[model samples]
Target chain A: MAIIEIEGLAKSYRVYQKKEGLRASIRGLFRRQYRTVEAVRGIDLTVEQGEFVAFLGPNGAGKTTTLKLLSGVITPTAGEARVLGHLPWKRENAYRRRFALVMGQKNQLWWDLPAAESFRLHQQIYRIEPSRFERSRDELTSLLGVRHLLSQPVRELSLGERMKMELIAALLHSPDVLFLDEPTIGLDVIAQYNIQSFLRHYQELRKITILLTSHYMKDVAALCRRVVIIAAGRIIYNGSLSGIINRYGGQKVVSLQFIDGRIPADLARFGEVILEEPPRAKIRVDRRVVPEVLSGILAGYSVEDVSVEDPPLEAVIAEIFSRNGEPPEHQVGQIPELLKEE
Target chain B: MSEHPSYLRVLLTFARNSLVRDMTFRGNFLIDAFSSMSWVFMNLGFYVLIFEYTPMLGAGTGWGKYEFFVFLATTLIINSLVQTFFMTNADEFGELIRTGSLDFALLKPIDTQFLVSLNRIEWSSLGNFAVGLLLLAYALGKIDYSPGPAQLVLYPVYVLCGVAILYSLMIALAATSVWLGRNQTLYDFWFYITNFSRYPMEIYRGPFGTPLRRVFTFLIPVLIVVNVPARMLVRPLDPRAPEDFLLPIFAILATIGSLAASRWVFGRALLSYRSASS
Candidate 1:
């Protein structure tokens, strides 16, 4: 049932090194220098059929490069990737008809024409039967709620509407595997919610495999149950969304409401003080020492109420990305200090 | 699914989409068509002025007013076909690489070269094509040469060969965009090479021009593109002139050579494409 299988996959780019001054530019014209940048460094992963997996990474973390490799847009520098039992980079027509890649920064739709025309073009490109094309086209348009806007030129549509139309155009062939790269990048809150809900609804109806890369944590949190985090061109961690909180999420926020106005000056010994108020104080405690810290705070002061919760999902994921290449011991006191800087 | 569509059907769909895209900006489309026609007319007028001073294109060459007009029309026909079908697509190819839209193109279930080469059609470029046909008719009448069946059949064949050569050249130039990151100057280079093919090949027989003429004729085969086609129609091969007999044979070789070379270059470029992933 694993539709996508990637093993020891890697991609590197040779980037020319040009100095700042005009003299360097002139010299570069004569003799150029290049440095090889490993964009994706041997990532191993698998996705089961109908699984919606979030590929999480900070900027320049090879998330998009991995997606490109799987989508057959670019060839890998090393190893192999098989999507639905087909070597993706071979780019066979049979394989292409079964998958779709939608990138947020670039548009596949023709700008000067209506979305309807682009949908028809996709029908021909994929060679979808007329009846099936019409059914999927109508279904996607209705699901995205852009039936009215389909007749208008794509350039005239709002960003959200355009993204929705782009989604509709991509899905017109009803591809079995979908790769979405930052699909909701620049949309407003409501637009983002609409897209998220639509993707969730569409996946349930189609039972298709999806691999999504997004900077927006809300997108990952809303649609994907499984999360794969990459940093510095490698997969740093891969597990369930909450598994992130349990693994790299070493800290739990313990907020206390004191009965008395007296606050302890030695609060730093219990945990890192995140917020200080007269009766209420929020502290970040190591999850492993939460019980001890809570008991110590209770034994020291008159605590009225206490709530212990995991830090925000974004905070935990950010911590995972920030702790990428450091030693384990160095990560112990890293997240809080990094959060403080933020 | 009922039946798979043919690649021809897919190309037609692309053409239709491009037509709709062009029609969306009616005013711009009209202006582009009008401006392109103006350029063609200006070139035709320039040639008319040149011929007024010189009875023949060259001292000993048989390229007089009517023959040179046919040569010019042949140039327009080949150039128009290349412009209308491939020029806009080639120009936009760099943007495709820069913006990473080539990713979507590669994802499609079709030949990448076929898709990239014909994705956009500048229908306005056909204005010059129409004028070229008109000039061909007028020149044929002026020359008072009634073409036989073989001559008529071979004329369109050579024009198609000329177009194939031009497309090969343009595609090869556009493919460089993958490595260069930007190839906006492709049209400038295209103009430089194609400007030679417009006039009679004999115009380049002087000391300096002779070597360039040989290079364009035997090496590049662009001179044969217009000259052979126009010669077959205007002047039937006298058994005495062996070059006229060799023209058809050379056209076949050039067409095959250019197509194969361009295909090899395109494949190599596609292999090297990084898809703007940095």
Candidate 2:
């Protein structure tokens, strides 16, 4: 049932080193220097059928490259990748018809034409039956609430509306697998939530396997249960969202409210106090000792209310990315040291 | 869907999409059509004035006003067809690579070459194409020429052969964008090569012209694109005439060779393409 199976899939690019000034530019005409950049360094992953997985990374962390490899937009520099039992790079018509790749910065819709025209074009490209294509188009456009804008030119639509149209165009063919690379980028919060919910509904209704790369933690939290975190061209963490919080996430926030409106002087004994007021205080503590610290604080102080929560996902991910040379003790379970450092 | 759509149907969809896109800006479409047609008219007027002072082109090359105009019209037709179908797409191919839109193109089920080559159609070029046909008719009338069965039959075949050669050349040039990253020089090279095919091949028969003629005739084979089609019409096929079978033979060979060469270059370029990152 593994819809996607990738083993050591990698992509490397040879980039030219261009110096400044006119002289260097002129000299480049005769000879140039190049360095190989390993964009995606030997990644292995698998996603079962109908699973919605989030691929998270900072800028230039190879999230997009891995998506391209799976979508067959670019061939792997080394190793193999299979989606629905098809080698992506082969790019057989059969494989292409069953999947769609949508990029946030790049548009697949024609700028001057209406989204309706693009939908019809996709129908032909994927050879979707007329009745079935119409049904899928109607369902997707209605779900995305973009039916009213179908006749307008794509350039005229707002960023969010245009993205909805793009989603409709991509789904008109009823693809079996969807590879979305930052589809919600640049949209406002409401727009992002709309897209997130729509994706969740579509995945549930169609049961299609999806792999999405996003910088927004809200997108992952709202739509995907499984999260794969890549840093420096390698997957440093791959597990559930809460698992990341438990593994690499060392700290938690504990807020307390005293009934007598008095601060505890010995609160520092329990954890590092981040904020303090007359009636309330916020402390940061290791997640492992959160229970003991909570019990001690409640037992010592006259507290009226209390809460325990993990740190924000963005902070946790940032810590993982910045811990490039740090000790491996923060890693959960076991990721070979070599894979962790790559 | 039961089976993949036929290529012809997909091509029609591309054409329809392009047409809808063109229609979106009616004013721009008109301006583009009118301006391009005016440029062709100015070129025709300049050539008409040049023929007024000269009895024949290139001193006994037998290219008189009517015959040279026929050659010019043939060049116009081939150039218009290429510009209409392929030039803009080839020119913007670099932008596609730069912006990563080529990723969507590669993800499609269709042949990448077919999709990229015919993705956009410049409907404005139809004005030039129509003018080319009128010019061809006018030149044929001036020469008092009536085509025989063979001339009428072979003319369109050679024209298609010419288009195939030009398409091959342009595709090969554009495919280099994959390796060069952004090849603005492709337009320069395309212009320089196609410019060579605009005139009659007989003009390049002298001492200095011989080498240029050989290079364009055999190596690039652009000389035959316009010359063969126009010649087959002006001078009907005569078995007694020297090189009488040249058009039939060279047209086939050039078409096949250019197409094969372009395919190889495109395949190799795809191998070297480092697609743009998100």
DockQ for each model = 0.62, 0.73
lDDT of 2 at A334: 37
Model 1 agreement with the true structure over A121-227: per-residue lDDT tens digits: 88887888889989988888888889888899999999999999989878888889999999999889999999999999999999999999998999989999999
DockQ of 1: 0.62
* TM-scores for candidates 1 onward, in order: 0.95, 0.95
Off by over 4 Å in 2: A325-342, B236-240
Q: What is the lDDT of residue B138 in candidate 1?
A: 95
Q: Over 4 Å off in model 1, which ranges?
A: A261-269, A299-301, A326-338, B1-5, B236-240
lDDT of 2 by residue, A239-329 (tens): 8999887776677788899999999888888877877886988888877788899888878878999998777777777777765423345
Among all windows of 10 consecutive residues in model 2 chain B, the one with the lowest summed lDDT is B235-244
- Model 1, span B129-156: residue lDDT tens: 9999999999988986678999889899
**For model 1, what is the C-alpha lDDT against the true structure?**
0.85
Q: In candidate 2, which residue pairs get closer than 3 Å at backbone N, Cα or C atoms, i.e. clash? A: none
